[model samples]
Target: QDNRISIWSVGDLGNVGLNGEYQGEPQLLCDIRHNGDVMDMQFLDQERIVVASSTGDVTIFRHHQNNQTLSANQRWEKAHYHVDRQASCGGAACTGVICNNPEIVTVGEDGRINFFRADQKGAMRTIDNADSSTLHAVTFLRTTEILTVNSIGQLKIWDLRQQRNEPSQILSLTGDRVPLHCVDRHPNQQHIVATGGQDGMLSIWDIRQGTMPVSLLNAHEAEMWEVHFHPSDPDHLFTCSEDGSLWHWDTSTNVSEKPSFLHQGGRSSTYFSHNTINQSVVSAWLSNDPTKDRMEITNLIPNQTLSVNSLDVLGPCLVYGTDAEAIYVNRHLFA
Candidate 1:
């Protein structure tokens, strides 16, 4: 990430400031109205960021470190939309995006998944109706496989190598129907993933074992939105919810299991969940920390409340955005 090219918004294409630390006064970099609200964005490399919008458009912006400028390199329109076997037309809104080097994959509200090459102007491949409901999130299981969650609370693994549009494996949340909002893979384990949904519930799925979740817990009072693992500290995790709370989970004590790798399709893969989590699934995994086992949660902001829409962690620092159109930044998260 370019430190200079810092502040941006998801709800609008408003004026963005280049320097995040410019507290004295704000400096505007670019102010171009986007096609629709920006849904997601990902780093293509150190130099470029690709942004996906609700209007089914994805744009790549190149940050010129030397000049302190950002330039639009390319844009793909209607990359994800609805089209039946009969070629029926129905426009769709883009929901999720993932970047794996030269390949770009995007899923949309129309339940379609599209793959593109950064150099190409349009989608090279399309999986129509990847889900019957809105596809909310997607992540890569391997270079040739992708995992996606839908409004129906179903998680499916799509094998890109297959000639068909069907997924190779599917996992259901429960007997009840609750929309899944976001999904994140474990930083250390390959097959482990945490899914948060509309009912304020969180579940962990071990893809190699089967479609069933290893553990489920009531994580929030309202709908859960985002989940992320510490980049280096696999023993910890963070989650945000519409209930206006941020939760920090510590599972250091439960992390005693030996690291194991599984082989499938002739490829050896490691579990993303840290050692203890790789083998066991407990409801309150956070309470395992021996040093501070008594206090498992620390509300990032205890005095006031606002629905946390998104949040992320990087080492000791944390940043979150709320529905009130405000951003909170905190340092020394682990401290």
Candidate 2:
């Protein structure tokens, strides 16, 4: 953890701090308070973090851990059109963002998803209405295909292959109605994704299978704001919620209990982003696969006021923030 730094953002404030270090007290190396609340963020690399804001802006911050300096650069100002509050959809507001080098994708309340290339002046292509309700998050499954969750907990898969502007497949998070707040796919097994939401429900989904969750459970007292699969450990999951809690979910123990991998030769596949229509690119293990047991969860933070809105998992360490304007550091979350 020598050169590692931790970053977190919530509401209007964001901070970058030295990781695994605190002699007497913890302190921020850089603090950024944006014009509006921060909605979503992703680390581009060791130096840059991409951020999306409620005010429709997507910005990038470059960090220098050696000097503890942070600088900001505007990527896209007024990235989406927030609808007028009077009309009901709470006026368009940006919700989340993800960066995959040459391209960056940002989603928002107005159901807009704009695709920007790092060198381009404006969006290369824009799905003006990706959904009817607010788009909470967007992720690249194969780069050519993307997944989005809306306020209604509806998951839509868009195949960039066609010139048309509609999703190839749409599914619901649950039979009962509950809004979804966040979604994260497995770092290695792209089709396996996790979702957390308004009802505090945590659901594991294998997009290739049927629409229903393989397993679902109440993960938090309040809304589960973020659900992430460890980058290095696929079996472990990390979640933080509005109940002001941070959790370490260790499914590593269950790895040995898992059924054997799906039989191959039963199927074959090929893939990319925005190029070929559905199947030529998007492929799944198969339908009717059995569900595994629920994961083992540890509450790293027992309790707190307001929501733990942001978090990031780094090896055996973790960092998360709460709506109370507080950030927590767990130097040995796994150890």
Candidate 3:
């Protein structure tokens, strides 16, 4: 609520025990006051970060690693705003931001989508009425395609290549409208996507298939705030919720190749071949047989009593922030 951006170093989280516990606090590196409430932030590159604000503005900040400080680099003011005729237009909160290198995409409460380049002051493309309801989150399906989740529990795929403002495809949950809060795409499979809703349910979708999600797993007890797929290991997933819990989902056991590993002594050893593994190693998200799909869900933070608002996974480390005004880092996630 203070509207400040702080940086910390979690590089020295130390080793994990056999039972998967680690000790070490993240060291504070720097803090900078932001112009408005920070809604979302993403690392644009090694030295820069792009931030979305409640004031409907997007700002870029450069990290001066040598001095452990940050400085504002560029700003795009009023990128999103309410369209009003009688009253003066008001800024609508920029709810989410995603980075695709030089290109940045932002979604807002105004139901607008803006695309901006890192070095440019103006938006390259703007989709004014991308949805009637507020857009909550977005993820890239491909370089030219992005999927956005909105307050009405609908997911729409927008093709950046097309000049048309309308989405190419739309998917939604059945029954009552439950706002989706966050979304993430599979690291290895562009067709697979995951979204967490206000109902605390996790929905897995195969965009290549029908309009409905393939699986809806009962997850957190309260609103799920964020969901992320491990960048290097797609089989592992992470989610945080307003229930004050963080979950690690392991879907490796659902892969059909588990049975083939037992017959390594015979010609079945050929199953280890790259071509064979690639063909057989289907993501559990696409599994049709629900009964055989085994997924292990572990609560990473069982004692935390405040909402975990955001989380990110890189290599074997997981870092998350909470409503208690704290950040936690867990290292050696595979252990």
Please name the candidate that would achieve the greatest lDDT relative to the true structure. Answer: 3
Model 3: runs farther than 4 Å from truth? 13-22, 84-89, 258-280, 289-293
Per-residue lDDT of candidate 3, residues 1-335 (tens digit): 56888888765545556655556555789989997789999999999999999988899999999999999999998888897523444788999999999999999999999999999978899999898999999888899999999999999999989988999999999899999999999877788899998999988887876688877888999999999988877777899999999999887774665533211124222123232222336566655432255578899888998999999988777888899887777777887
Candidate 3's TM-score: 0.89
lDDT of each: 0.72, 0.69, 0.84
Counting clashing residue pairs in each candidate, in order, gives 6, 9, 0
When sorted by lDDT, best at the front, the candidate numbers are 3, 1, 2
- Candidate 2 has an lDDT of 0.69
* Candidate 2 lDDT trough over 10 residues, lowest sum: 278-287
TM-score of each: 0.79, 0.78, 0.89
What's the C-alpha lDDT at position 19 in model 3?
Answer: 53
User: How far off is residue 49 in model 2, in Å?
Assistant: 2.3
Top model number, TM-score = 3
Cα lDDT tens digits, model 1, 162-252, are 9888999999876887899898887656577888999887777778765667667667889998888776765577889989988886765
